[model samples]
Target: MSESSIAIPTVYGLRSSGNCYKVQLLLDLLDRPYHWVDTDSSAGATRTPEFLALNPNGKVPLLVLDDERRLAESNAILCYLAEGSSYLPADDWDRARTLQWLFFEQYSHEPYIAVARFVRRWLPEGHERQAEIPRLLERGGNALDVMEDHLGSECYFSGGAFGVADIALYAYTHCAADGGFDLSRWPRVGAWLERVRAQPRFSPMAA
Candidate 1:
C-alpha cells in the first residue's frame, strides 16, 4: 500500500502518563503519523461509559486502528507498532531479550517507580498515600539498581540496540526524581538515558 493510503492510528492517552508517553515516543522516533486524543485517566475520563465501551480496563494509552480494533497495554502497543521495524529485533534470541526487558519494565520497574511518582506528584499534600512513599522509594531504588547493573555491561535494553524496551523503561526512569529517586545513585543508567535522548527524532515527555 502507498504510504499516503495508510490510515493513521489514533491513540487515546494522557500526556503525562509514562505508559502513554512510551507510545508517543516510539511513534515520534519512527516518524510515524498518529492522531492523539487526550484522555486524562487521572480525571476519571477513562472511567466514563463511552471510554469503558472502548476498553473494559478503563485505561488511557489505548490504541485504535483505522478499522476501530483497539489495543490496551502500553508494552503490547509498543510491540505491535514496532513490528517489522529495527525497533523490534528479527532474530529469535534478540527478540526474546527485548521481550524480557519489556516484561521487566512493567513488572519490576514501573509499579514501584511510576506509582511513586504518581503519589508524590499528583496526590494532595498530606494525602494518606503519602505514607506509601518511603516503601515505594526503597523498592523503586532496587529496580533502578537492577537497571544500573544491566547498563554496566550493555548500552541499550533491547538486545544491544536502542529499541522498544529502552523506550518502555525510559518513560518512567527519566522522571524518577519526581518520585524522590536520586538518579546519581545509578550512574550507568543515567548515562544510558543520555544515549536514549541522543537518538534521532527523540521527543521529551510533556510537562
Candidate 2:
C-alpha cells in the first residue's frame, strides 16, 4: 500500500460492550487517533456479510489497520496495540504476566461477569436466560474474589503497572454491579477500580 493511502486505524465495536470498551479505553489512554464504526452484535450487526468478511468470528472490537489488515479478539487487540508501550511491558516475564491476566479475564472473568450483565440488562425479564443469572453470579463472584485477592498485594494487573490488563479487567469490573454483583463484597477490587479511574485520560464506558 502507498504511504499516503494509509490512514488511522479503524475499530468496529459496540460502545456499551466491555470487550469493545477495552479497545476504546486503551486507544484513549494512548491518545491514539482512530476511526470507530459502531457495531452492535446484539443487533445482528456483526453477523452481516460485510462484518463477517472482516472477522469470521462475527465479533465486534475488530481492529482494521489503515492497510486493511484485520485483527479480532479484544485482549489480543490490546496486546497488539500496546506493543512497545508502557501498557505492554518490555520484560518477557512481565509480558507473560500480563498475558496471564488477559487470559484470565477472558476465560474465568468475562464469561461469567459479562454474560451475567448481558442476561440481566440486555435480555428482557422472564427470558430463559434469566435462570442462568444465579449460577452466573456465583461464578462471577468467584472471579471477583480472585481479583480482590490479587489486588490485596498488587496495585495493578499488568506487572505492577496500570496497563492493558487493568483496562481489560476494568472494562467489565467497573460495571459488574450491572450484572448483579455487589462491588462492596470485594473492597480491594473496589479500591482498584478507583485507582484505574484516576489514571490520566481514563474514559468512562458508555451508559
Candidate 3:
C-alpha cells in the first residue's frame, strides 16, 4: 500500500510452499518490488477470518495487486503476473506444453510428493499421519522418475527455456529431499535444480 505509484502486486503466504514460492520466484526474477505479508499456512492462518475473506479457499500464494485485485492458486497467479512476459511462451504449442507440465505437477506430482513433505516436515513426528509416509515415499519417487525422464532432454520443463513451467516444477522439486525423495537417483534432475539455482535473479524459496 505504498504511495509510490508502482501498482505492482503484493504476495501473501508461507515461504516453504511451492505454490507460494513460485510467485516469489517470479517477482524476484522480474525485479519487481512489492510487499510480503507472511501467513502461517501450517497453523491454519489461511483459514482465519481475515485471510479467508481474501480467498474463500483459504489458500496460500494469494496475490493482492496495487489496485487490490486478489488472485489465488499458485499456477494461476504465476500466469496472471507473467502475462506479456517471457515466463509465458509466445508460441501456441509451446504454451500448451507449459500448461501440460503444470497440470502434471499439481495432479501427478504435488498430491504425492508435496503432501508427503508437509506431513513429514510440518506435522509432528509422532502424528498419526506418520503411517502414510511409506506410501508418499513410493509415489513421490515414481513422480520424480517421470520428471527425470522429461528433464533429461530439456533445460527447462517447457520451451527449452525458463518459464512458468520451470517456476511451477522447481518450487517442489528443489525441496523433494525433505520428504526423503533423493535426487541422487535422478542425476539430470539434480542438474536441473542447480540450473534453477543459477538463474540470473533466482531467490531461494525459503529466503
Alpha-carbon lDDT, every model:
0.93, 0.92, 0.85
Q: Which residue pairs in model 3 clash with each other?
A: none
Q: Which segments of model 2 are wrong by more than 4 Å?
A: 1-7
lDDT of 2: 0.92
TM per model? 0.96, 0.96, 0.93
lDDT of 3 by residue, 89-173 (tens): 8899999999999899888888878988888888897999989989998888888899889887788886778899888988888
lDDT per residue (tens digit) for residues 64-110 in model 1: 88877899999999998888889999999999999999999999899
Quote the lDDT for 108 in model 3: 86
TM-score, cand. 3? 0.93
Ordering by TM-score: 1, 2, 3
- Expressed as tens digits, the lDDT of each residue in 1-207 for candidate 2 is 343332578999999999999999998998888899999888899999988889999998999997788989999999988886899999999999999999999999999999999998988899999999999999999999999989988999999898999999999999999999999999999899999999999999998
Clashes of each: 0, 0, 0
Per TM-score, the best of the predicted structures is 1
For residue 16, model 1's alpha carbon misses the true position, in angstroms, by: 0.6
